[model samples]
Target: MFKILDKQELAESIIEYTIEARDIARHHHAGQFCIIRVHSHCERIPLSIAETNSQAGTITLVVQIAGHSTQELAQLEAGDSILDVVGPLGQPTKIGSPRRGIFVGGGVGVPAGSSMVRQMKQAGAQVLAIIGFRSKDLIIYEEKMRAVADELVVTTDDGSYGYHGLVTEPLQERLAAGEKYDVVITVGPVVMMRAVAEVTRPYGTHTIASLNPIMVDGTGMCGACRVTVGGETKFACVDGPEFDAHQVDFAELAQRLEIYRDEELRAHEAGPHECRLEQALKELG
Candidate 1:
């Protein structure tokens, strides 16, 4: 059983949990994720490892209560025990000798990118991070990203905060300014990552996007997370939650996110135990 050590409300419906998972945190690294199960009957869900401290034996998970499992997970308070917590799964980000790097994170991707930014900075890379949201009320972790990154740009579609546009704006400006980045990592909404790929295409920048598809199992066997990268199929779980953004098929990914659309909606309306983010947002409304 994983013990909940702390809980925080980041946004209206978003909750961050710090769990005492000694074994999991001890082996966790930046960019790794975990598959959480609320109980024996709960559906498996993948969540990013927002932060971890091996010495403290804790792992932090920032989750927007979107579905059933996540909604249930949110109601859990400190000292509550989770039925199962299975990870530090998938490969960790490779921040080799960080040249100049740009980290782009949108919405929930903000927290995930926060850890990666800190990790890359700790490795001696000058980090420039961009975080975006629909509006000011939805934004999170800008200051956290700024603390580690050398430069941080915040954007919102409605001009509610920071720049009034997508994260791609400043990214292009950097490119125009003759910045040569060793890597461009983006994690966010499907459309946002796709847009990132489009803008960086001509520049030949290596853009890595953290792929969040319909993953049944956090292993290669399920083949549920399979995606075409450079015309070849790869699983987002075992192969990557991160991939070459340039070669990724964003159209196919968008379709996959809708594959279970009806069922997901049905599940959402059924109860808070259906999906984490959606359910929580509904409850907030």
Candidate 2:
């Protein structure tokens, strides 16, 4: 059992979790993820490692309460022991030392991207980070991202703060303005990554993106996380959690992600699931 050391709600549907897991934290790296199981019977869910403190025996997870498993995770509090925590799984990201490297993240992906930005800085690369959220109130990890980044850009969809637009807009402006970067990395929804790829395509900038396609066991056994990259099928859990954004088939990915939605919807509507929608509607009545 891994103990929950700290858990805080950072924004709407977003949270920061510090958990105690000695083995995993000791060797965890950026672009890796851990499989979290709420209980003995619950299915495993994979979450990116935002940060890890080996000496403290703690690993941090930044997550959005997206579905049943994540919602259950939000219910856990400090001092609670999760049923199981297994990882440092997936191939770690490999970045070259460059004059400047830009990392882009949207919404919950910001925290994970922040982890790489820090490591890249440590490795002697000047890092410029672009982090985006729906609004100012939803932004997270700015202080942390700023700590390592030589330059940081924060953007929002609703223009509540920072650049007052999508991260890609500023990305294009910077690239177009001749702000050259050896490499660009983005971690976010498929649509966001697709857009980033489009922006960087003409520039021929090598772009890396973290892919979180549907994962079940978060292991090679399940084969649920296989994704086509460079015309070959690879597993996200073991082969990668990051791939060249240019090579990823985002259309297939976006489609496959919805393949299980119907069953998920049925599961939610079938009852026996705790849901906010039910409570909210009752309160309204």
Query: Who wins the lDDT comparison?
Result: 2
Residue by residue across 1-285, what tens digits does model 2's lDDT show? 889989999999898999999899899888899888887655567889998899999999988887766767888899998998889899888887777899999988888887799778877888889998888899898998888799999998999998989999999999999988888989988899999999999999999999988666677876778888988898998989999989998888888777655544654565434443323324434
Model 2: per-residue Cα lDDT at residue 25: 89
Note the residue pairs that clash in candidate 2: none
lDDT of each: 0.83, 0.84
Total clashes in model 1, counting residue pairs 3 or more apart in sequence or in different chains? 12
Return the lDDT, model 2, position 139: 86
Query: For model 2, what is the alpha-carbon lDDT of residue 35?
Result: 85
Residue 240 of model 1, lDDT score: 87
TM-score of each: 0.92, 0.93
lDDT of 2: 0.84
> RMSD (Cα, Å) of candidate 2?
5.7
Error of 2 at 126 (Å): 1.2
C-alpha lDDT of candidate 1 relative to the true structure: 0.83
